[model samples]
Structures are given as C-alpha cells and as structure tokens.
Target: MITIILICIGVLFNIFGCVGLIRLPDVYNRLQAATKCVTLGCCSILLGVVFHYGLSDAGFKALFAIPILFFSATVAAHALIRGAYHFGTKLGEKSVKDDYKEVVK
Candidate 1:
C-alpha cells in the first residue's frame, strides 16, 4: 500500500521533471528542475523498494543507494550549471537577476 503510493509519487515527480526539461526557458532553470525533481523521484522510488523488500538484499541496496543518489545528483547538477554559466550560456529573457554576476566580476 505505502509502497504503491511512494512509487506513484515518484512517477509523478519524474513526469514533472521531464515536462520541466521541455518547458523551461533556459539551461539553468531546466537543470534545476531536472536535478530536483529527478533526485526526489529516484529517492522516493528507492524508498518504496526498501519498504517493499523489508530487510532483504534489495532493500539493503536501496538503503545504501538513497544518500548516494541524493548527494551525487545535487553535486552533479551544480557542477553542470556552473560549467554552463562559465561557458557563456545566456539566461532566459524572463530571468530577473543573476546572483553570480557580481561574484564573477
């Protein structure tokens, strides 16, 4: 029951992430959406696996994978966004402010 609910939530988040990737105006926004939604989705799916499997081998693996997935996804997304900014990717027209501009100068 709970496992099904978690899996459904995960699926919804993943769908939202995909939509964000297609709908967002700029690379940064897309990256933010992809990173946050996908990470949460994956983690939720893994949590469901853990719940479904209890203390079995699959559950143990999911337990170990959760933190690793979270941290790595966040770090990877930050690195990609930073790299894109350094490489001269422009912000979208709707973007209000760049917090990094003064820092880069």
Candidate 2:
C-alpha cells in the first residue's frame, strides 16, 4: 500500500531526473536535476524499504542510509558545480543571471 506508493513516487523522480539530464542545456543545470531528484528518489525508496521491513536490521540500515545519501549527494553536487564554474564552464544561452558571480569574485 504505502510502500508501493512510495516506491512509485521514487521511480517517477528517477525518471524525471533522467529526463532532466538529457534535456538540460548545461552541466550545472544537469547536476542540479540529478542531485535533487536522485537524492529524493533514493531516500524515498529507502523509506519504503524501511516501512516494509519494520524496525528490523534491514529497516534500520535503510533509515541510516537516508540522511547519508541526502547530505553526500548535495555536497558532491555543489562541489562539482563549483569546480566546473571555476574552470570556466559557461552557462546556457537561456541562463539569465549568475548569482554566484558576485559571490565568487
């Protein structure tokens, strides 16, 4: 029931992330989509596993994995984007403003 719903939601997020990777114009945007969607999707899937398994060892492992996945994904994405920006990766033509430009300078 709820487990199935959560799994479905996670799958949808993963699908959207894949589509974003294909559709986005630049590395930064692609990284943003991949990081956010994939992190949420993985967390949701793990939560579904926890729900299905109760508080057993597997469930406990899933619970512990959630926060680790979230934080690591966010941090890694930020680092990658920052590195790309510093290395002179240009934004897409449609990009309006670089809020980081002033901060980085």
TM-score of each: 0.93, 0.92
lDDT of 1 by residue, 1-102 (tens): 999999999999999999999999999999989999999999999999999999999999999999999889989998999999889898999988888988
Local accuracy of candidate 2 as per-residue lDDT tens digits, 6-104: 999999999999999999999989998899899999999999999999999999999999999988998999899889999989999999987888877
Q: Alpha-carbon error at 76 in model 1, in Å?
A: 0.4
Best by TM-score: 1
Give the least accurate 10-residue stretch of model 1, judged by summed lDDT.
96-105
**TM-score, cand. 1:** 0.93
Alpha carbon lDDT of each predicted model = 0.94, 0.93
User: Can you tell me which runs of candidate 2 are displaced by over 4 Å?
Assistant: 102-105
Superposed on all Cα atoms, model 1 deviates from the true structure by an RMSD in Å of 1.2
